[model samples]
Target chain A: MTSYHSINFAQKISKLDELWSPRVISEMNEYQFKAVRIQGDFIWHDHPETDEAFIVLQGRLRIDFRDGAVLIEAGEMFVVPKGVEHKPFAEEEVHLLLIEPRGTLNTGHAGGSRTKPNDLWL
Target chain B: MTSYHSINFAQKISKLDELWSPRVISEMNEYQFKAVRIQGDFIWHDHPETDEAFIVLQGRLRIDFRDGAVLIEAGEMFVVPKGVEHKPFAEEEVHLLLIEPRGTLNTGHAGGSRTKPNDLWL
Candidate 1:
């Protein structure tokens, strides 16, 4: 029988031990849904190939752009357009659901030590 | 300056007066994130061209397939594969976030009176 399980955001997020590291939870077409826990500031980066969506599951998220910043609280979301430089910061540990295409990196084109391997399932 | 506003799911869902009708909130690439309020049973349909993802923001949801059913509660999500017939039912009113490609109809190929206009923004 095909698995009819649902992906619980909080449940999957609880299993994530590393901050800034997102693990794939599900996929739709070529897009992927990832669960991640983040706190503090992230590196500035830009996905030249695809847009990135951030859905806040718990706590607040702030994405700083070149011109302004967006504050995303629980039950809120923001989408960063492709080729826009952004740096994400969280005051507290924030659980997030990131939706983007497969092979999209956490650090975008700003490859650094913070870059985690893609397609790591939770 | 570019708009730096975030989309609040609950705030958007509250503006919806019609049940089972989804309104576009934001877009990431070719995909759109829609907020909707739903209750009762939906028509059995399947998207042949792409998959559909449903993220429950409040209440419980049950998606019935030919062989099995998947129950998704608040903070949970499920992606119905392309060409898989499924019907969604909710015991009470449910706040939902739907992610699908642009121009996707709520009623898929089983279009009928239940098919609402696509791309209606909130």
Candidate 2:
């Protein structure tokens, strides 16, 4: 018998201790759904290979692009186009549901100490 | 000048007048994020090509399988594995955010009256 379970965003997010580190909660084919807690500012980077999605679960999130910025609050979402340089910022701690292809990095090609390991499942 | 905008689930869902008819709100790579309002029972179908994700935006949702069912509430999500036969039922009107690859049909291979048209954008 297959055990069916629902993935709760808040419950999964509660287990995330570090900021900006996304932990995989589920997968759809080659794509992955990750839960992350983020605050402060993130480095500007571009996913040259794929687009990235951000679903704000709590608090507000701001994604700054080269030309403009988008503010996403709870119950809101935004998609950053591939190859577009952008940075994420939050005034307070925010819970997010990120959807992207497997093996995609948080910092894209701008690898640094802030880059979290990929495929870290929760 | 580039225009940056956030996709609000409530705002987008407000435009969806038909039940079970998913309208595209955003796209990440080849995957499309659709907003749908549904109530009552759905048909049993399976997507042989890709998995389907359902994020409950409002009300409770239950996906019944051959053996068991998964109950998902507001602020929760569930991913139905590929090729798994399932049906969705809601006692009350429920709003959902569906994530799937482009051109994925709601009824999968179950070509009946319930099969909604693909790529309907809002």
Candidate 3:
């Protein structure tokens, strides 16, 4: 049987409304993951040197790239490897947790309407 | 303020026993993390090609090394980089979550008395 403080990703998603914002859930080593609610369009950005993992806890999100795009729904995850320019957006509000090294930038290169400040705890 | 589906590390530790064994709490990407309860004396081993993170959820655990030993307690985390020979043990029961790439070995260099099989969910 599975046991250990089970983090209810669904339960958390029901409690917020906003876009491109995240909340810290827990920390391991020097890295911690933040769950955020996102909607509409996020700014174009990329993390030049770190790989990040995004897990869809609810709704849907699409990542736009220079070459193509990919859509992700709840119960799915995508790893945006470092140095890849990508933009994330949604038709409706979506819930997600972003996993990466501590101090990772929310925006990669084009930091204009959506680059979030570092260490904003949800 | 902060809110999200909070996974209680302390609450999880109160529910299990045994050594080098783990329990799954969540899944992301193709990887999942399992929290394990461990105790006295494990065999020396090494993971040749993956970085593993160990977060001490409760009690105290010590990682034995070829030249030194590091003690980690609750609220502490240690990363054992790939290809390092090490052993983990505790004076009493210690709770932890081992994070690494999916399919990484529990026992790396030498697999004898303490190498755990892959995918044993707690």
Task: Evaluate every candidate with DockQ and list the scores.
Answer: 0.75, 0.80, 0.06
| Docking quality tier of model 3 | incorrect
Q: What ranking emerges by lDDT with the best candidate at the front?
A: 2, 1, 3
Q: Report lDDT per candidate.
A: 0.94, 0.95, 0.69
Q: Measured with DockQ on alpha carbons, how good is candidate 2? A: 0.80
User: Which stretches of candidate 2 lie above 4 Å from their native place?
Assistant: none
Instruction: List residue ranges in candidate 3 displaced over 4 A.
Output: A1-4, A15-17, B1-104, B107-122
> Candidate 3 on B1-122: residue-level lDDT in tens?
12213244445555556567666655544455667888888888888876677767678888887877787776455677678787888999888867766677677767676666777654
TM-score for the first chain of model 2?
0.98
Tens-digit per-residue lDDT, A13-105, candidate 3: 555465676666655445666778888888777788777777676788888877777777764456776787878888998888777767777
> lDDT per residue, candidate 1, B9-95, as tens digits?
989988999999999999999999999999999999999999999999999999999889999999999999999999999999999
What's each prediction's clash count?
Answer: 0, 0, 5
lDDT of 3 at A84: 76
**Model 1 misplacement above 4 A:** A1-3, B1-3
Predicted candidate 1 versus true structure: per-residue lDDT over A32-106, tens digit per residue: 999999999999999999999999999999999999899999999999999999999999989999999999999
Candidate 1 chain B, poorest ten consecutive residues by summed lDDT: B1-10
Model 1: lDDT of residue B121: 99
Instruction: Pull out the clashing pairs in model 3.
Output: A45-A108, A46-A108, B23-B122, B46-B108, B46-B109
Cα lDDT tens digits, model 2, A1-118, are 5678899999999998889999999999999999999999999999999999999999999999989899999999999889999999999999999999999999999999999899
lDDT by residue for model 2 (B40-118), tens: 9999999999999999999999999999999999999999989999999999999999999999999999989999889
